[model samples]
Target: MAPAGSAACVFCRIVAGEAPAYRVHEDGAVVAFLDQRPLFPGHTLVVPRTHLETLTDLPEESVGPYFTAVRRLTGAVERAMEADGSLVAGNNRVSQSVPHLHTHVVPRRRKDGLRGFFWPRGHYADETEARRIAARIRAQL
Candidate 1:
């Protein structure tokens, strides 16, 4: 695990509010926010507050709480986006854009065009749009 104060880690900076993020849910244990590059309109990333590099590095006692938050966020995301279902996934190391342990909760719909592992990212039209989506997700929580 990297130090919580690791200045080089972007996710750490986001958690510290040093970097900008549209955070939807935050608690003592975790933070859930809109993904800047979203797989879908309501894509979100749920991250632990601590700077654990990967899911394997997260403490055993933290696993349940960590996933519990992920589960709750998944439902909120799907409902907020009016999607049929969601994809809750985490990368231990491979394909992980940020080193910090975070889960991707992506809202899914039939014929939504997501295929296999090829993720086509999208962006919010503006900050206002991001904030609106974030607010909707927050409301569902």
Candidate 2:
């Protein structure tokens, strides 16, 4: 059966050459394109050809190759935009604008006006609290 929501997924349309995109890179398994609403010029989104919905949905065997593509695109975005650095980020269902999974590689420069993560920062209440949180996550993995 087709992967869930592929019929309506924009990224799947882009992957199938059914939609127009400012494509920067493509391979058998991945596609990279400029974001229409770029945070900064040269911001690109990289996605797997398969319509996996989240990072956890990504097949373990595909993780290395998939991220390798993102890593390469990260460098290219920095060079092309003459940026001092880059932010490579992805969101799960919480902040995800689209249901399709994509990695955002945005060029960054010093004093770019963006502070950390566009949200307030916080610290663990104490070492005990931090350890409890870590242990909870470790149990899942």
Candidate 3:
């Protein structure tokens, strides 16, 4: 499990109340919030309270409830957005953007034009610049 001081992570900000989010569901164990940069209208993210870099790192017991929340969120997204299909995916490889674990529950339509999660990457000049961005966002959390 990652400690609260893991400053270089986005999910930590949401968990810490330092950042704002369109929170749809929350509990002692997990939080489901709308994705800021969404693939679809009702795209949401299900994240555990405890930070785990990858699915393999989280305790086996947590998988059930985590996915349970995902299913529930998907149902809500479907009704609210009237989506035809849905896609919930997690990454263990390069597809994973933030290292801290998060599952994206994307509400899909018939012609969303989204083939997969592909976004271009831009690098910062140095660690100082990255820290500045992280700190600024953390303060807003």
TM-score of 1: 0.80
lDDT of 3 by residue, 1-141 (tens): 446536677788888777788899998778889988998788998888888888888798998888888888888988898998788888874678777788888888877898754777689999999999999999997
Name the runs in model 2 displaced over 4 angstroms.
1-5
Q: Considering only N, C-alpha and C atoms within 3 Å, which residue pairs clash in candidate 2?
A: none
Candidate with maximal TM-score: 2
Question: Could you tell me every candidate's TM-score relative to the true structure?
Answer: 0.80, 0.95, 0.76
Model 1, 1-141: lDDT tens digits are 568958988888998999999999998889899999998998999998899888878899998889899989998999999999988888988899888989999999989898756667888999999999999999998
Instruction: Estimate the lDDT of model 1.
Output: 0.90
Task: Tell me which of candidates 2 and 3 scores higher on lDDT.
Answer: 2
Q: Tell me the tens digit of each residue's lDDT in model 2 across 1-141.
A: 246436688888889888899999998768999999999999999999999889989999999989999999999999999999999999998988877789999999999987779778999999999999999999999
User: What is the C-alpha local distance difference test score of candidate 3?
Assistant: 0.84
Candidate numbers sorted by TM-score from highest down: 2, 1, 3
- The count of backbone overlaps in candidate 2 is 0
